[model samples]
Target: MRRIAFLLLLAVGASALALSPQEGWDLVAAVESGNQEAYARLVEAYQAGDPEAGAALGVLYLNGVAYPRDLERARRYFEWAQAKGSGWGSWGLAILYANGIGVAQDDQKGFRYARESMERGYPGGKALYAMFLIGGGAGLKQDINEGVKLIQEAAATGDPVALNVAARYLASSDLPGLSRDPKKAREYWERAAARGYFLARGFLAYDFFFGIGGPPDQKRALELARPLVGFEPAATAVWATALYFGQGGLVQNRPEACRLAKDQAKLQAGVATIYGLCILEGVAPGERALGLAYLALAAAWKHPPAQSLLSDWQKRLTPEEVNRAKELLKNLP
Candidate 1:
């Protein structure tokens, strides 16, 4: 959704003739300052005939940013703009259809609109179309080579999302035609992070923590991960791990770290293992039994470290204690 909004902003900037030069500047300021009333007034003033204004207003309605959430109204505005040959409107409608926001979910129709938008030179649509081609979804044929080329082209436009995607492809060692180029991946991630892509920030934080493509910099890892704790689950786990070990600037706080690990365990298997370890080590008071139980749970999930630890633990426990742990595992959520 953030990517969609970014693309819409780009489209609006490109079509600035929708309003007078002064009004366009005011609209940009209003958007930057999040002045909803000013934005609404400008959108109302130009929406009748300006395709750009119609597309922007549609996005505002779709997201309900200071306006009531009205999918039907958004669809109407998108359709109006698309009829006026607005590529952004085509992309917007494609998104709605793809996600079933206001219309029935129809991947085929969504792909058609996306293709149309891309053909009309919408960079966002090109990126989406590339993804569709790569994933072979929406009845599109899989063409990894072509998809890579398209994404590279889109990245050349300095689209942050495209840069992120390109970085992932370039960094993946498992992809058949791509080589793992950590240096290039770091460059792409840095560029995207500078453009405010939080996802890229999380990737860079992981790299910094693990010293991938560079020397370990725990301080930089903490700096990048701190603000993303609540917003990015993977970063939260990284931050918690760093806090637990005091590797970064954070002071050691095993209890808080254990709590954070436990909270994130369901979303990340590694975090589950970390939580189990915290419990097994008695890092927090009164958690030994539950920690063993969590270790059992992680072993059940096929985490190798947890499996090894549980195996050793079982050797030290009596049959009755083993039965109790099994019972606890059965009752675990």
Candidate 2:
């Protein structure tokens, strides 16, 4: 308990007041655990149009802290906060655009909004803007040196998002002038993950689980990723797969795994494959027809494993089942 508390404190420190790691958890606990005092304070503050209060609510909706994930709701709240001139809200909207959460991916809008947030003096916004600058995304002029310098500045102030952006760039490949440094990349990623940066946590989980940059450590992957089951796409898929197959030192729990897979389905074909297989086996307590439909969905996304599974599964189905599954797929919104 002491260790966890210490780590939480460290995470809070790294967020630099702009992207607070503690934003949702404590607030959500206060609401869901029925702490009327805390709940009333939040309600009053929000009713009084406090931007921080509004942004905190937006974070709760965005991250599904003690609630069902609802990206549209999060977007609404973020918009409200942004209207009140909260840079934190701008940062949140940038994240939504960058990740296509509850909206179409629009790098131009993302870049514009992230730049706005940075200009408004938000630390997280600086990191976000630098991330876009690093890639020169969406017609923005590439400024690799400027981006790296900005990230270094933000990281010195302990901005976790800045750490994540730097680590991601270093880990991916050698840049035009900068060489890849695996050890530094690992350290930065681990620190950002511990500070609850979504991209860092997810990326680190995938890399560690598969040995992309180093030796695979399945146990470490699960340990880092379990908290992101409903929050980060790739990490959730990794954790759900581990649970489904009893791998990574975890016992099999197909029902739970399928639940996570279903939440993240269609985002990645791997998630669709897991959910489809689980549904077929009744672990998801779903119709075998629906299972085939999901596999078809995955196949449409061009996942090779899903295509193979779909082909193999279709061979065992009657023609009627195949028709029903295809019809269901067509009807899915």
Candidate 3:
């Protein structure tokens, strides 16, 4: 009876380990595509000690993507993967520690883990560690040149996050040892956009609209900006500005522009300034009080243009009206 029971336990163990790596990959793909049944199977495989599945499960729990957010569970799965010596597991732990997700925030621990993962040749870890080096946070020495080199190397691997960060660094003039190069920025942005990064599309739209980095392509700008409207307020603000000025092959429509500007103002201080200006100038007509309120709201947020406008207008209002505007500003969310 003892031998029979031992044989039965062995059979159960073999059955639990039956999933092949290829099958695991397929399940991972299915989970990414939002198949709940596949996610369940993958979870089972993770429980059986499949390191890749464990790491993937950790990410899902961390991000709260398909699974409910459970940072503790995420940490456990990451620990399992780390026990298996997975580089990605180290990277996962680094992120959690850095962000204070599942445990007390420890930047030094995070940086150490990130460096270890990078040394182990994890792509995400390389980018993350390079970022920390660039910013010089968490006791790491600042080295912009070295950081840029690492970023460029990671970007060359076509990782979407790396592509975006590298593009931004290339476009920014403020970074030491890096000059703003619109053409180069556009190249990286284009690559990231092709890989379906939506923010890249927004950046490209802004660039095309403003003639930044390349000759302005108003038509292209409008084409890119139109589809992103409603969902991307910053992009919407750009499109609305273009529409107000009749640039980018769009017909001038002050009413529509004002409407769009007002819609975006709640989310962006710059848009609030635009909306206030439209009201103050009567571009929206018969809305001076509304304009003052909008300016007050923007000014409260420390927007420079709104503050400048408010300073100039303060002299025009009676003390009572100014107090009323101040009250409105205080109440703004």
Clashes of 3: 0
lDDT of 3 by residue, 1-333 (tens): 999999999779747754533344355446756788987777676676667677667766754435666779989988888777766678778888986766999999899888987787666578778889999989888998898778878777775446666776777556754467878888877765544344566677767766767887878877766656644554676677776778766888877888888767776555677787787778886435556777878787665567888878777767776676666655543
Cα lDDT of candidate 1 equals: 0.70
> What is the TM-score of each predicted model, taking all chains together?
0.55, 0.61, 0.50
How good is model 3 by TM-score? 0.50
Per-residue lDDT tens digits of candidate 1, residues 1-333? 999999998677656546532243345335535777767666665544777567666655654433666889989988988898877678778888875767899999889888987897766568678878988989888998888778778878775556776776676544554467877887887776654445567777766776766777878877777766744555676787787778777888888888888766655544666776786677754445566677788677555557888888777667776777677766654
- For candidate 1, the TM-score is 0.55
Local lDDT at 325 for model 1 = 69
Q: List the residue pairs that clash in candidate 1.
A: none
Tens digits of per-residue lDDT, candidate 2, 1-333, equal: 999999999666534333232353255446645567766666566766666567667765665534566788889888887887877678888989987888999888888789988887767788789878878887878898888778777766655666777776676556643357766777787776654455677778867875656788898888777756777876887887788889998899998899899888867666787888998878887778888998899798655668878988998888888898999897653
Q: What is the lDDT of residue 19 in candidate 2?
A: 28
Best by lDDT: 2
Q: How close is candidate 2 to the true structure, as a TM-score?
A: 0.61
Error of 1 at 252 (Å): 2.0
Q: In model 3, what lDDT does residue 99 have?
A: 64
Q: Model 2 clash tally?
A: 0
Candidate order (lDDT): 2, 3, 1
Off by over 4 Å in 1: 1-125, 137-140, 263-273, 279-333
